[model samples]
Target chain A: MDSSLGGILSPRAIRDDGASMRLTRTIGLAATLMLIAVGLVFLRAEQTRLAKATLALESEWVHLRGERWALQAQVARLRTPAQTRGRMAIFGVALDPPRPASPRTPLSRLALVP
Target chain B: MNTRVDVTQRRNGTVVLVGIALLLVALAGRIVHINWTLHEKLTGIADRQQSGSTIIPHRRGLIFDARGRMVAGSRLVPDVFVDPLLVGDVDALAQDLGARLNLDPGKLADGIRARAGRRFHVVARGVDEVTAKAVREMRNPAVGLTMRSARTYPLGASMAHVLGFVGRDGVGLEGIESWHNEHLSGRDGRRRTIRDAARRALHGVEGGAVRPVDGGHIVLTIDAEIQAAAERAVENAVAQFEAESGVAVVMSPKTGEVLAMVSWPTYDPNRFGESTPQQRRNRVVTDPTEPGSTFKPFLASGALADGVLSTTELIDCGMGRRYFGRRLVKDVSPHGLMDIKGIITKSSNIGMGIIAERMGDAALYDIMRRFGFGERLGIECPGEASGIVYPLRRWTSMSAASIAMGYEVAVTPIQLAAAFSAIVNDGVYVAPRLVKRLLTSDGTVLEQRNSRPPPRRVIPSDVARYMATELLVSVVANGSGWRAALDDYQVMGKTGTAKLPFADRKGYEPGAYLSLFMGAAPARDPQVVAVVMIRRPNPSIGYYGGQVSGPAVREILRETLAYLGVPPDGTVAMTAAYRSRPGL
Candidate 1:
């Protein structure tokens, strides 16, 4: 009975068991915190890249819209009849009347109706 | 032994410390150098991204008439290019493109093969809208299209001279385009993008764009309808008289604004290269010819203004000719004794010489100068001539006689028109201008051009009125300009048939004459002044200004008055029926 009590209260045994428990808990907490920090850093870098791309696209879009407006205005101004006639006159060209059809007799016109 | 061991340990420790210090210093220097180099490279990249890669082409401005109708403008077109290196099956590709684009398959294959290593080659230029659409839909990876603006003359040949033509790169070559090139050419912008090493667009760099500025619009003072009428008149006269060339100008007497200026043999701006340089000349402003009898009115005006001659004063024009110092000044018909009004009406050289002698050369020259002769009309055209008006000191006795009869003096059609305007416009000489106003892109007037201030009174109001009234009688009575008389309007005009000077100085060409007619309508209060010149008309047509060119002027004036809704003068019938009646 005395030997049994001595084994149960052994100092080496108690020391070894306490040391294993402390080491395991420290390793587990350290690994979890490291993973959380890495994930947050990756997410932040991706958001920054997307914001930069979006800004560049918006600027390009604005520039294109301005060019479109200028082209539209030019087209609208070019397609008009009065302006066309004025330009032709500068070249000293005059418009001519359409050619008249040949005269047909009344009897010939009636025969064609049949 | 113990001391030796301790000393060796201390020496080793010192060596280790020195090596670590040297390594740290080398590392710091390399790091600083790399950081500075990176900063410089980044700055260079930013600058290149902002300025390089894409180019912006300048666009030509639009030209519009007074009614805001477009005459000349720019239209967007596509330019096609091919990447020769990327093209596969050259023959097959060439055949397909040739059939669709109307190109020779062999030529396409040769061109593509010659530029084998090149990334791009121009396959076609100025493609039509339909062809451009087809090209875009082709979806061929090797082909690319870039949009560019091209100059278009919508009115074709009508507005050619006024609107002018542009080169392939859209630079104005003549007319108003050449005159106002700087204002019409807009600034180009650029779009810079970040590109990979292969020159493929990666992404648009931050702040890498410059917007293009559009050219300002030009509004002409000419009314399109009036211009068309004037053009028709000139064209008809040119064709009818078989004249080598002709010109007509209509101007507002009050403001000297050119409403219609026409020149025959003018080329279509749309096809300028197809015509000859002689046809391209703006004869109204560029070519100067002898004033012929049209100059008689000015001589008459000067004499009347100086009180040297009265309308009723009789002058002797014995027979049909008179000898003045070995020079013969001939009259169209023999006049025993004629009044001042009769001398102008008959266009008598002998009678005019007698009047010119009383006025003296200095007085006549001064009057001509004051009327804007021997000077440019200050028009907007580029190549305007200053008509020849020699100084009185350069004149001989014969020079005075010849100048009085519309000889030895040269004047442009425009100058003649302007001078006639002064005669009818209360004697105020104003410079002629084609540009009425210059506007910004958004219809804001940048500058409003006003008529030039009158330099000096060449004639008094009464004398101007008297001369104008007499000219009106000449148009209706037995004057040469009988055909120019309007049916229901009081036509005031003068007829001039002056001999053209030969290059050989053989006095003057006998049959070769420049027929001219200058007049204003509604005699009492003139609104418009027209001058017409027909050069080298068929002698068989009896090349008289009153006969050949007068009818054209009448038609133009009638149409112009009707178009402007001017009411007809009821007094025309009485004026037309009234005979010379000696003094009446």
Candidate 2:
């Protein structure tokens, strides 16, 4: 009677069930590894995007510096004595440089608040 | 029949399963071999495909005058270049680019075709910002722009010989620019980055990257206003006299600071290529000439200092001519007997020859050396000439008399000015200073104080004061330098008219002369010493130093004194100061 009952729960059936469980575990680990790899790829792309933005800012900064220097140079050129003289000659007006304030200068003259 | 079919099917299924297992094992082995064996090679290939590098350009320093006005500066301008290998439809592209850049299309096309194998060809350098923007907006892969600093002299030719011009390679070629090139050319930097597939820099790499340090800024002691005035004065003199060239220099007696230095026939630094080499020479420090009567004060100073001649001593003028060992010493006019003061006042060559004889050659040479003649004076300029002064051992019999009358010796205008400053500065031989301070890009200030030798006492203070205040004053007051007199100030100076020597040093050139005047003003305590030198003026207009350069010196001193806020001699306080001084 006991042998007949053992025959009902066969060793082949246990082997089949164990094979199915092993397959399920293998598929689960592989999906987890795939998720981690895809996450890393997205992180790398985001990092590259940030770096590109930084590079753009750096390029803009350099350009602004160059522009600032060019403007300063232009201002300097205009301030040259030769340029001033040419302008003075062209305008036919004599422009005397304002005298620097000295100890002798009156306070009212310096204030210019008439 | 059924039993036999089942047995065959089971054997075939077993064979198929074994075959499938062998294939899977072989695929796994191949994967292992690739990952382990070819790892380093493949990784190297990937790194090379995803790496980029670029140079971070460095900025050159600026040059400013004493008033903080920009004399020489630099700006980042774009250099246009083309990649011939990458250009498409070369003729069409060249036409399009040439139309925008004002270049000839035929030449541009030829240049591109000729350089087809090369990666880069320079189309233009230092393009203006607007042109650079136009090129950038072209959006063509073949065209590119690189930033480079272009040096600009804002004051143009007015400050050319002093500030100088920079070369195409961004190196200084002359004057102060050349002397301070290393300090002006800052270090360049480099950057390494990781790139994407499109060759865009994705990230800066960790190692082998450097940041650039900017160059130090140079602040010159030149006052821009005074420099302009001096330049205008010199230009006027040159034009009025129809001279070959001219030079004017103004310096502070107390600080040895060069306030203004102008060399005429000057080339504009912005357009230096259009000028000749002669126009580019800085004659103030580079060319030496005989100073003629301008040298008499030093001779007189040496005589008085050595007790060789008294202030009241009388010497025979021999009626304007005397012979010293076959060399004839002649005066401008006949004078019978004159005191030491009369000799200087009359500018009698025979009288100076007698004084030279009394004060031997060695003593005279020593005094000239003490007065900073025949030496470089170490001013901040390139190609400075250490003027010619023969040693006592090489002195001919007539050399003493020749030197005494300002011959057989050479002195640059700067050297003469520095020597005269010794008299003006109360006997101190202070070195000429062109640079006042050097400010680094980091905001650190480096004062140029005590960089060279310290000031030395060249003569007794009393002697220098007496010479500067009394004798020189008398020269402008009652002597050859009379043209240099100013109505509002007591002008003190001497005039010189030296004949130009032949190129081979054989003899003087007829009808060619260097008219020179060196002077200081307000007389009691000298503030500024100015030297005006005019070369090869029209003899018809007048080549005398007192007539030509004296008036120029008078103009310069007048403007310089007024600019410096020095009170006029007519002021009661100024007159009292002159009266209270012991030496005067």
Candidate 3:
């Protein structure tokens, strides 16, 4: 008689009830889909943030590049002959015509000596 | 009580159904109206707002001299614009900006006021960064700044004719700038971006964008220092002589590289518009002048080559005057009997007439054609004049005599220089070249130098040597070009003083002479071939090529040769610069 009662109240038979089993299966799937949706939302937010950051950086890069070129042009302008002649006043001496090397102690002779 | 409760429930259900139906009808009506009636207007608005693309202009090429000095380049500058809708205190703002930008305050104010009812106004097209920075500091809501690139010529008008200038639309207008405009102007880029209500680019939303490719750089054969030296000499000579114009060319005879070319009454390329069209013209490549006595050597070379004349053959100059084909041919100075060599040395017009008479027209024409005269010579620069060369059939009885004495033909200064360079280059002609190479922005060489044109063989080397040694060498040593002599350097050159023709092209203009000095240094193995020409100078200052242009050539050549450090040849005391060199 006890064996018969144990068989009737077994864990497998209680799990076989269709109404409760269906409810648990449906809940598990809904929870899984909800988690996946939550993950995707976070991923999209991160991607947008990165894209916006890259755009801002690119714009800044263009601005800085233009600035660098302008500075280079200015530097080149200052190095010109006209500018050099105009700015020679700080040295308190005028630029004279360039003189040639001394023939008495010639560079060719010096190079040949050693 | 149950019946009354059922009735209340039924009434509430009916009211709820009615409310739901009304909401559905209104939503459907709105959808139909928008799709059918308002499509075109909304689409147009959307296009104006979102479809427009912004251009990213490509930077124009940079021009570098032989020594890698930037002569012409582009720089990014701020262009000032205004939104009249957002403007405040236009006059006050104009005054504030005028002081910094060097603009007329009244003009700015007037323009700003005139722009009323307009949303946008170009206050200033291109402005320096410093002025733009000041404007930004003011933080005026009305003012807006856009970046634009402008061509900058740091050396100003030093090589303006070659470097050329950019138009307001950033296209090359003349010189190498125009010839290589395709390579100099790189492809512009573009991008699509979302703009806000204020039509400002949204940096957050980056979309389709094409990055600009900066233009290639051009490397010229011109040496900046040598160019400056040549220009200075020409400038001084022009001013001192009070001449209408002057041009000087310094070239490497072996390579046909034009190291320096200068024309007087020059204007700064920085302010190219202020220059007259005449000043803007590169006369070395454009204007052709009759070569006068310089034609003597080429004719001599031709005669000697054809065995029509020998080195020591004596010809009577008839006391500096002779009748050749009913024309009274006279020399600037009197001469008696002159050999082929003495003819060039004394620049005897009568002597040349005799040589030309013997050589005839066809052979002379063929030799001149080989010498690269009366032809373009096909240089890298633009606007080259071919000069006037009559056909063999067109030669008159007097044509040969006139041609021999450097008349009845016109030749550009560069053509004359290159032709003389041929004589210096061992009787071979090489076309004059300006640019050495073209380089990409990243320094990749896009185009190497132009291949040398086929070598033109004009005269035999032995004849060329005799002309260089016996004839041209004497011109500087003891002849008309004596003023161009250096104590320790053998100079081979000719002096030419030709009469300018009248506007009517009828007869020559009196008292208007074009004085020219062309020569090569260390004549034994020539290096630099230089030419100096002064046009329509005041006769009082001096009009003779020997006096006006020779001394100038000597000084220029002395400086250039010193800079070159080429060892001297002649047995004489050297200049300080040459003497100072390490070895004697």
Candidate 4:
């Protein structure tokens, strides 16, 4: 028993409550879908960034390994007998003179079981 | 008028509806066509444009000695490039690079200016680590550095012939490198990735990824110390005799493990371009020459094993000369009468010729084959030459006499050494092996599960012992191999002074001789066999093997035995000979 102004066209008819409810539900569903799509895109981008970072780290480690091998090659070249003879002073500083096999007699030390 | 208006309106509405309906049908047809036909093609085109892949490079393997020292290695240097347009402060960058790389800054600037429109211009290759680090630290957007590998021979010319050089594109070109290339250079992997608008890899799967496997490692049986001694000895012999070329081998008689193998005219693999083609050849395993009297011991072994000659039976050498058919063969020295043992000890050609003719061609050739002649020994070396022995059909009247005295047949140095190793190993022949083991990148040892050869009997143990004691021992004691005797060790050996063919492969090359000495140590129970061959030594300094290659063998055996810790079995006599007569 609500009051009305017009004879046939009243405020209750103008409201159209069912249609409004339907429009609100459709908008809410569409907005939720849009949020989910944006979240998936961001997740993809983050994954790419992390993958690139990991590859960069691995490449650095590979580089370090390569450098270590190169340095070792150089050291081997420097330690050859001919090189040692040429640069005796340099190796003499790092290496001690020959240690005596034992404090006892030389023949005893030379005597092996073979 | 009202009725006419109604009919016109109806016609107009019908026409408009029909047109609208047709347009709607066309739009639906177009949508279906796009979904069914064009979708796959457009998607394929997009994928081709957006995704890419590249090979992940793997480093080549290294060669190591038995003691785990690096003989051949690879260094990962940088291949530096630059984007000429994007490079800023060109003068400053050029100066910095020039200082680091030892180049002229002015020339570098001019080179960069020439590559005006190029995105990538290679500035330097094989840039060392320190320079590469300095360039990277500059952080210039234009400067790009990619890793490249260059081979390195740490010991230079030490084992250059064995550990060969690599080619321009990082493939093995020679020596052990080429033989074990598949094992040395592992399979390269690939990285398939998608890129964004800025062309950065998203690291996603387009197809799939394969993990790269690094090359397997190789360990040789050669000891670095013993190899050095052998190399020095050969160098000294070549210098002393002024020989054209020389080869030397130190092998363990028991296992046929080659301790040291050396060839003169060796080239450093690092600077492979500086040497001539002649210097690059590994004559030890590749070159076969006519083995003169060194072939006599095999003949004696054959004669005894076939029961054609008794150990005590005497053959008259008759002043060192013997005639067969029309050819007169002469020995190095004169011997009147000798047993089979005496013939070997004296290296008498006539005695050997008579015994060999009695044995005939088939018996001699069968014995030769049993001793591993004219066939490749499969020593894991590249370019091994299978020696030449004429077949039965090719034999002439002089063939038996020639073959009997160690001529008409050519043999490689390694073949002769291994043959004598059988005599030293108590009549059992084991083919020589150079590669000790193979290891994976992760330290897993790979066994040669297939390539091992079984030991074979050549002569009986009694005949071999007699040969080692009577024939070989006497050679060192008083024969042509007298100079090869060591003071502390019991030396047993033979000598060969062979005439070489002319360069045209015709008759003998006058004044050219191949002086060779083949011997084993601790003659009573031989442990090691050393063979030295000096090609075309100067006649002025004496071209006899006992003189030319003997001293070198002496020094080499002394060093190798000491390194192996072989105790002196003849010390009492050795002390009298060498210990300065300490009590005198």
Candidate 5:
């Protein structure tokens, strides 16, 4: 009685049962692999972003340093003794002579009763 | 049988599960190590990438005169910079900046294009405060203003020789500034900053910092008021005489400190580049000339000190000419028979020749060396020449006679002045000095330069006193230096009119002579010794040292005496004694 019942079973039902089990095993493996690949891609994108940021900062540093050098040179030129004297002359400044008595006797003592 | 089989399977499953758990734990340990290592590397890279802020320069130190008046110093000026990348309307910006800053449009354009993408380039430098304010008000985003110190000289053209000028690079080119460059320049400071990708300064980052050390200040011994007076006197004399060049030096006889040293045809330190080499020279120290009759005093002192001649001893000048071998030494005029005092008073060439023969060349050369002739005064100023005074061994028969009359010997004005000062200061020869002292920023005397030795006695004090008395008589009675005589003071001095030797000319060009007057006032005890020399005065008025360079000494003395407040020696009789001498 067992052999006659088995022989009467449909081919579609047998194929469906084998196919569903194989699909389940394949789907489980694919899902696990997909999760690992997604994690790696996210990490790679973050690293690339950080590298660009660092490069940008270096460029800015270079620019700032250049500015500082130029400014410093200009300041040095203007503060030189020759140029300063020229500017003062344009402004009409004069030097006062030394008061021979300043260092010797005080001016008060040198003054006469007249 | 079923129970035994089920128990065996369960044991195997448990062993497999334990193996998987251990592998997973090992993988987690590796990942954790990698993350820690990566974090460290990333942090280091980020730190290296951080930007720093621009450095700002500090002001330089100030240079003041002896009176604490600002002479060479720095003043704040505006500097303009542009970020070419941010600049708009390039032509308009160029025109505006060029107009305001006095920059050429073409130069401005080239500057902007030179560093097109650069964050900052100097658009204009050293703009006045008012102009800088105007630029700031323009409110251009591309333009930036920086306040910087520019060196300024308040006294223009007056003390140019001593003060010196700075180059475009802010370094001293000549004079005192050049000599003390390191002490007069400041150390620059720096600042650091962190910036983002857009070059915006980031806060909370370690700001790098360095403070600037300002340059040391200098205080000169020159008196500006006297300097002006001296300059004016020299200029007026130079113009009036139509002289090629001239020099005047006012010095303190006791200290050997130079108060005012003026050389005519001088250029302003501010416009040094535009001046000729002749104008740039400090003739007082650099140029050597035949001192003419001025050399007679030193010779006379040597003769007196060596006991070769007495002040009262007489020498004969036969009709202005004396034969030395085949050479004829001619006096400017026939001085007739004269004593040592009379010889100097008349500046008689034949009279000096007689004294030279008695003293001999060796004794005279030794005395000249002791008086700092033929040597650099060792002053701080550069380019001082060692004047030419030949040794007695090199002297020919003619050389002795010529040197006696102030020829065959060349001396700088400084050396001449120093020697005269020594003679009048009781035979004590003091080395001349320009710098008085060096001071710190807080007015502390860092160093005092008064370590010079007491003057060496070159002549007897009594001899020097007698010579001073005689010199006073010369000025008051008949010497060419009479113009240098003071109103209420006894002035003693000599006059020199040496014919300039030309490479290609005949009969000395009639009027080409170095007119010189070397003198001291308050003859009883001299305080100031002044030397004035005028070169190549036009022959229109019988050019002589007495006629050309004399009045300058008078002007200087009058002003200097009033300024010094030295009471006049009312004893004018000393001058009368020389006037009563026989055969004047």
Candidate 6:
């Protein structure tokens, strides 16, 4: 009889044990939800940072393309015949002007006296 | 009394609990309805706020001369515009823009005022790098800069007629530009991107981009060196003689490739708006003229081919003048009796008239048609004229004689050049070609799906060779075209001086003349055929084709032959058999 009494539990004690278990479960669920929310926010921030960097790089690429075309145009202009002739004149190798077929005839036979 | 109060308290607590439960139920139902019924709509709104599309600019093709020199290219330049409605302190804005763009501040302000309500206005177009940088540094929200691709011609006015020009809307308007616009203009690309709150593209979407296709490159058959020489010679000749205008065409007699074509009074295609339509005209292919004595060689060849006359056949030329069917046919000078060779050397009209009378109208017309006259040669240019060839049905009583004298027929300079090319190209008529090949942007030649037609035979090979080597050579060696003889090479050619007809078709212009010279060099094995035509030289200076146009042809040929490194042959002497004796 004593052993039986020793093994028996009170309703108040059982009620207290159940309440503690429920409290523990509720706290674990809340912690897991908080962690998931923090993970989502961090991922969003990283995506935005990467997008901004890519935008800057793309802008630079476009600018470089424009620069390339401008440089090509400049090089072509420098290689033109007129520019080459000008450079030749800068040195001592200028081309001679064409000589007329006949000696330039006198524009007037005689000048008028003042 | 206690029991009654307890019951009332229980009733009030029950009522409050019921109200709380009902409100919770309504909130849960509303959440379900939004998640299920409006899901797609809400997602679309979010995507609209985050993503957008942008166009990637395309690059037009490049044009290179045969020497691989870039004659035309495309460049990116900033085109600045203003939003007048967004402008603040208009006077300050104008002053800032004027200082950078070299515009009058007052005028700019007035322009802005005139467009106050408008959202957009052009501030400047195609600004250079320095000016564009200054405007960008201003950082004004009211101003905007659009990067546009513009065409650039490195050779400028030197190749204006061949390279043509592009319009403000990126459309080809003239010359090779218009002819090959489809191959030269590439397709623009589109990219789907995620945008920021300010409507700027942040990053591209995955698999959402359509890449641009760049235009193909064009290689022309024009030799820049030869082209420059021809232009210089023609320009100098026109200026020397004080002529109205001039034309020069240099072509490869072996391949019918036009090396250089220059039309005097040319305009700078870069500033085409400042020039007149007359200056922009490509007269080499578009203008027609009576060939005069130049037509005599063709007549003689046709008569020889028809078996009506032989090179050694003799006929009497009466006192420098004769009457054929009431048509008075006169020569520049009288000749007694001569064969076909002497008649060509002396350029006798009476001799040509007698030969044409024997051939009759049908035979003569057939010969002219076979020579590519009175028809478009199908050259790769715009507005090629089919020149007048009055058909056999339209012939009057005097048509045969007049046609033989080169009076009734009109031919373009290119047509005449091609006809002469046929004679020099060993009897084959090869159409003239300008473009050599097309290349992809990456430098791979495209397959030739549209090759030129094969050369066809028009005259016998032996007959064509004899005319170019024997008869035409004599004309330059001792005949009227002696002025066209070059010092290093043996030149074979003919001369023509024809009266210009009035525009109204009433009669010939008073004292107006067209002087022309057509020739080929290294007579035995010809290389290049050059034709020079001078329009309306001062009659006082010289109106004869031999005097005015011959020297220009000589200069062009001299430069071209020297550049080509053709070895000089000793002077060509007339053979004793073909030389005109005092009394043949």
Model 1 C-alpha lDDT versus the unseen true structure: 0.76
As a whole number from 0 to 100, the lDDT of residue A21 in candidate 4 is 60
* lDDT tens digits, residue span B79-142, model 3: 8877665567888888887886788989988888898776567778777667888888876656
* Interface RMSD of candidate number 3: 3.2
Most lDDT-accurate candidate: 2
lDDT tens readout by residue for model 5, B1-584: 78888888888888888878887887887778767867788766666455535555555656665666666766555678877876777888888878877789878978898888677788777776687878877777677775555666667787888877777677887777787777777765655556565444453233355655667777777777667777877888889988888899988888888888888888877667799888888888888988998899888888888898876777888898779867888877887888887788778888888888777778878888988889887876778899999876788878778888788889999899999998889988888877777766556777777616556778888778777776544754566677777766777788889889885864455557899988787777677778899998887854688788888887877677666766676435665665676655
DockQ of each: 0.04, 0.29, 0.25, 0.27, 0.02, 0.17
Task: Name the candidate that leads on DockQ.
Answer: 2
lDDT winner between 2 and 3, please give it. Answer: 2
Error of 3 at B237 (Å): 0.6
Q: List candidate 5 stretches off by more than 4 Å.
A: A1-114, B1-56, B84-96, B116-120, B138-141, B193-207, B451-454, B503-510, B577-584
Which is the leading candidate under TM-score? 2
What TM value does model 1 have?
Answer: 0.77
lDDT of every predicted structure (CA atoms):
0.76, 0.84, 0.81, 0.81, 0.75, 0.83
CA shift at B86, candidate 6, in angstroms? 5.4
Q: Which pairs clash inside model 3?
A: A101-B580, A101-B581, A102-B580, A106-B582, A107-B582
Which docking class does model 1 fall in?
A: incorrect
Point out the higher-scoring one by lDDT: 4 or 5.
Answer: 4
lDDT: the better of candidates 3 and 6: 6
Q: In candidate 6, what are the lDDT values of residues B306-354, reduced to their tens digit?
A: 8899878888988998887888888888897888878888888888899
The CA-based lDDT of model 5 is what?
A: 0.75
List residue ranges in candidate 3 displaced over 4 A. Answer: A1-49, A83-114, B1-23, B32-55, B83-121, B137-143, B197-200, B204-206, B571-584
Over A1-109, each residue of candidate 2 has an lDDT whose tens digit, in order, gives 5643344335664466687765665577678779999999999888877877766776676678778777878888888777877899899967444433443456878
